[model samples]
Target: MTGDQGTGALAVLELLAQEAPAARIEALLHEARRAGAADAELAELARAVELARTVQASAYRGRDREAALAALVDTAHDLTSPYDLDSLLRVIARRARRLLTFDMAYVSLRRTDGTSYVRTSEGDTTALNAGRELGEGPSLGSLAEERRAPVWSADYLDDDSVPHRPGIDAVVRAEGLRAIIAVPLRSGDTTLGALYGADRKVRHFTPDEIGVLLSLADLAALAIQQAALLERTREEVTELERFGSVTNTTLTRVRHLWDCHTRLARMVLDGARLSTLARAAADALDGVLQVRDPGGRPLTAADELPDLDEEAVTRAALQAHTGRSPVPLPGDVWVAPVTAGAEDLGVLVLRASAALTDEDVRLLELAAQSVAALLLIQRGTAAAEGPVRDELLQDLLDRPHHADLHVRERTRRLGIDLDVPHVVVVARPEGGELGKAVAWSSSYAYRCGGLKAVRRGCIVLLLPGSDASAVARKVSAELSPLLGHPVSTGAAGPARGAAGVAGVYEEAGRCLDALTALDGAGGTASLRELGFLGLLLSTDHDVDAFIASTIGPVLEYDETRMTDLTRTLDAYYESGGSPTHAAEALHVHPNTVSRRLERIAELLGEAWQKPAQALEIQMALRLRKARAALRAHRTP
Candidate 1:
């Protein structure tokens, strides 16, 4: 070729780059003909022009692909912003139509059936939304799956080369759809679904257009996966927050429980009153709390609630005792057995005005425990206060003359006033456990501020009282059931000083012996109840007082019956216990004397003829006569 042909070829390339019309190409070919060119030269120049045009068009297409690639990058960024599968799909569909010059767009996620249906649609009005059901019929999605590549159709109704589904064909015919392309939406080896672009007019799809749609589908699939992960993360965060809230509430409740129990423990340690402790616990439990003795007597109360329902409290207490814990009543009340092992100290009762929970019951039980500890301490002190009290009482009773400053200080320390008017009581259990009897006696003595000593099968007590007989009766009444038998008790008192105590103890022993011989010591008695014999044993020895007590019944009977009962009784004892001889002295028959003696026995008691009663009667008769003579002489 010549320089002219080379230069013309270069001009054709420039014109093609500028995208000159076909008229300019023909005019250039004519100018080559006018250049006196040979047919071969002209034809060669024409061929060069065509080759340059092809090269220029190829270069321009490459630049267009570059722009498409840059737009796909921006689309990928926009797809990430959607943050949800549905929204990301919509963005993908919209960007696909705008980037690829389609009139409508839509998206379909692949179902498990391996078929495609329109999830989102744009750019086409069509009933051909169902691409294919692979098992049922051949579809675009199935075809893509089979080929592992994109599928496209120009004039889909007329095209027989591509796979067609009848349902898809019917819808395409109704909507007049022609050109169609579907790209597989893929992430790694998994094919999610297909993205489709279609037009109503038959048109061929360029490779660049198909590439653009495939890139968008890839970005959308990644965005959809990311959205699913983000949704899962949000759910996990919500669950964690809810769990943390529950844990925080549990921790707070535990802290409150610890504080309440700690306060209760401190109250017990500080020796607070039962009422004070109950009040604190009631505040914590939001209820009316009470501490009761084993007998249901209220020891302390936290509120002015209704009067105690003793029956209900007792039933609940029994239930609690059986369980060895707290129990609920018919009402909103609960009770806890206040006990130390098998020994039931008392009960803690609570009447709740608000809802009562297991935690509140736990607080009630703790209060009961505190109350049990206090009661046990008290019982420990009263039942047996070590050996101090027993030893001091035994020393005083055995050797009273040895009383010294130490005894005085010990008595004072033990809350005893030895110098005060006091009584001496001696008791023996009739038939029972001796250990239990002694325990009962010791506890009773301590409660009354007295000292007790057990010596030689006898419980001896020196208590602060002037009435010996009353003290003896109290001991018997209080100890009979506890010791499981009758208590034979005797007392003597109104004594003072160690010497007086010792003397009264002897007198009290004699009284006990006298009662034992007469009544077998099945009951209580004292010198004051015994009569002239008691006067003989007593230090005071008031003869007139003894006479009045010993034969007062006979004297009063004689006065009421208008008979010589006292004189006949004196005559009878004067005749050496012979009713016949006494009748001779009294100017009456033996039968008459016997009748009067029988009446005397009726007035006194059936045992009036026993040795002790007989001796007392004789002494009263002699003392009465002596007192009568003395009064007669003094009056004259």
Candidate 2:
């Protein structure tokens, strides 16, 4: 190669620079030939041009590196801001559009099944991609996810390498999309989705642009994961708060129940009566409380309770005791069993003005336990005192001579007087429930001031009263139901002192016998109400002696000889001593009546016809008639 030839090549190169493309290359060749350069010199001119082109390419690479580095730094700093998934995605898309200078930019996430769902978009054509789904078959986004790398298309509409989806095609046409660059959003080895930058006119994407998008995709994936963790932590905190609220409410209820139980237990320990405890329970529960014995008699004053249906309460209480459950009664009432171990002491009835909750029922059951204990104690005390009371009563009624001073002193201590008008009631319980009768009598004695005892197959009560018959009737009515059967009570009194009591008791026993003989079950009879029958019913009356002394000879003549002498005498006195009228009343002849009267005078020692003797004879005859009438009436 000669210096002249090199000079000529240099000149052609400069000409090439001045002109352009194929025509300019031809002009350069003409200049080169005119310079008479050798073939070797022409080759040297080509090599120098190639070297200049290489230098220009290096400068362009340097500029691209600077831009890529700046984009990476901006993305790194942007990620440090506290942004939620939605905000982070929008920022990433906007930054991508700015860095790559594309017509549109967007971010999409891959669903669980690996389908890309576009989340955010930026720029003029963003509307087309908003909320769009990119399928896995072969779009640029799908390719990026499938290959786990960046994908690009210089002209997407003409690119047949990717599968054509109608929706994607429509949007691409509407937005005039010509080129696109997609990079997968990845965390570790997993691909989250894709980040897209698109151009409306044909454009080739460079490696630097793909790299910058890949960095932004990484940041978006991290933001999505952080948001998920934060959401889960918030849900856990809410659940814990709910559990705490429930626990606090339960603790409050338990504490209230404990306080109620403690108060009830303290009442029991203080030796409070069952009625007192029931009142306390009512106050605590804000309801009515009734403590009943096993027989359904209220241990507490029934007046203090509401007007409850006792029958309904009884049935409900039975069901509750049998089933071991709280039975609901009408009018917001509840019935529960009061028990001590296996023994049922009674029933506890609660009638609330308001609706009761389950906790209220529990508190009532606790109170019931305390009441049961009190009732048991009362029964124990009653059992211990019954026998001594029975002994004192028997001695006073049976032998007043031996018991006069002792009885007087006992009555004094008991706050009653034997000298007062008292009735002796002798009750023969026809039901044969002796145990129940005894218990009832004992309880009656304790409640009202009286002495009651079961003796000689009968219950005896000595009560202060004005009328014996009235007292007897009262005792019968009261004890009958308790014993679950009828009682025949006989009373004799307004009797004073122990001797009077003994005599009245004898009369009362005789009355009891007469009542039974008449089959008058559950009937109450006294010496005063027995009428003429009282003469026969009582041993103290002397009607038979009087009749014998007054009309003895008449009785003898009538009994020994079948005669109308006694009948004739009664007829004569009833007719005012008229023989004719007597005969007429006797249904006989007047002369026969005269003869019968004369026979009557002979038998009576000659004063029988006088006014005084006649009055005595008439009285005796009247007594005989009454006795006959009584006998006839009682025969059946």
Candidate 3:
């Protein structure tokens, strides 16, 4: 064992270790053959000689060399494979332990807030069981924060400045571990976290080994970023699907609303009462509107709606209209102006149970606009359809036996729902001012699929697919609102064919005359809720008695003074108690007209100026005229 010989032997062993183990074995066998030993001796000599003739040293060196190379290959394959973050990190940790000859290894990742977390680990049970929170000491944490490349600590436990976990120091001391390597896990300039490894004995980590671990950490960081991107993409797709489903459902509901509107329009065109249509519209809207008068007074509300102040809604509507913007209120409520062109129909207020986004607001506005258009279209259709239906009915009345199958066929073709029992409702507008009201009412009825006709000052509504009582009640209700004065509706029972319809029309006229007589006498009346005056005016005897009782004194006064008291009373009623207008109508001085009105009022008593009294006097006047005509006709 000379010093030169020893140096030569060490160099030979180092060179042999760099070669593969199998190649080294073959070189050893060739050396034995060159030594010229016999066949049996050569076999013994080949078995006995190590590369450097140091059995333990050579074996340890060879094993470590092979293990390192295998680890390098494994790590290369892992880096190329398409795996998720967690799976890829576990592979890195396991391979790191083998390549670096460490007791443990781990991958830590930085949270969004700059804190680092141990995401993967490979080690003995005691160290691995610390979970993800382990090994995030000051050294590793600082490396992540500052984006430092790598940090090495020899005698980690002895270094007071280096951070350590609770039992980590004890484990390091017990195992005689003396070195740690921390490499930053980075992608581009962004440092994600750190990869750490520890050896059981003091060892200087080479720059080459640190570079390899850093490269592997970079791959792990990329996987983490990719996983996050994939998750985000999945969320976006899910939201799109949900939006499509919701839009489809909304379209289906809109179609149902259109169908209801069509049915209601037919009713209006047929001159039917609009009360049923109003109820139907309310039902369709659900709680979309809280119906109120023009003055911001509440009229009716659905049961589910709270008792809201109409004044508040009106104020909100005014603000919205003035500003030309959607106005928000408490409880996620909003009000939109229901306008068509320049016409301000009203306001639609909505209370959403959830926060409304821009999309929800736009959709609701569209629905409101549709409703306004439907209202206008229905009104126009009813106006045009009313007169045509009335002319057809009149022609049938004039020639009962004429070949009028054309009218019947047209009615059938219009798809009128005539199967149900129906009645004729005739309303002779009070004061002969029913033309405009009738036009408006007919428009409304046509929109609701009811038939309306105007002849002279009277408006007739033919309610199909409705019972007599219901038609009567509905006609009274709808007309009452539009006239601003109580109107009497006469129901002429059920009728089928055109001839039957004509007969019903005549019956309705008779009933109208009777009801008008009652109304003229200042009486409360409706076809459905008729009182004693209804029965009294319906029969000839009762009609005579009513005339005598109500208008006999006025007639006597007019005949004795030749003052045209009837004309004076008419002038007073028409002028709405305006003395000047009444004087002009009577062609007399204002004072004179005023004095005559006072006298009439005094004679009729204080009750006569009231709506009830006015109604009674007007009915009495009509009854008196009808009696006079009846008597004159009989004498002729």
Best by lDDT: 1
TM-score of 2: 0.39
- Each prediction's TM-score against the native? 0.39, 0.39, 0.36
Clashing pairs in 2: none
Error of 1 at 255 (Å): 11
Which residue pairs in candidate 1 collide? 103-123, 104-122, 104-123, 105-121, 105-122, 105-123, 106-120, 106-121, 106-122, 107-120
Q: Arrange candidates by lDDT, highest first: which order? A: 1, 2, 3
What is candidate 1's lDDT per residue for 98-123, written digit by digit as tens? 88887666676777666556676665
Off by over 4 Å in 2: 1-281, 291-307, 339-346, 401-405, 408-424, 431-436, 447-449, 463-485, 492-504, 526-636
lDDT of 3 by residue, 24-51 (tens): 6456557657766467655454444453
What is the clash tally of candidate 2? 0
RMSD value for candidate 2? 49.7
**How many residue pairs clash in each candidate at the backbone level?**
10, 0, 34
Could you tell which candidate, 2 or 3, scores higher by lDDT?
A: 2
Error of 3 at 183 (Å): 86
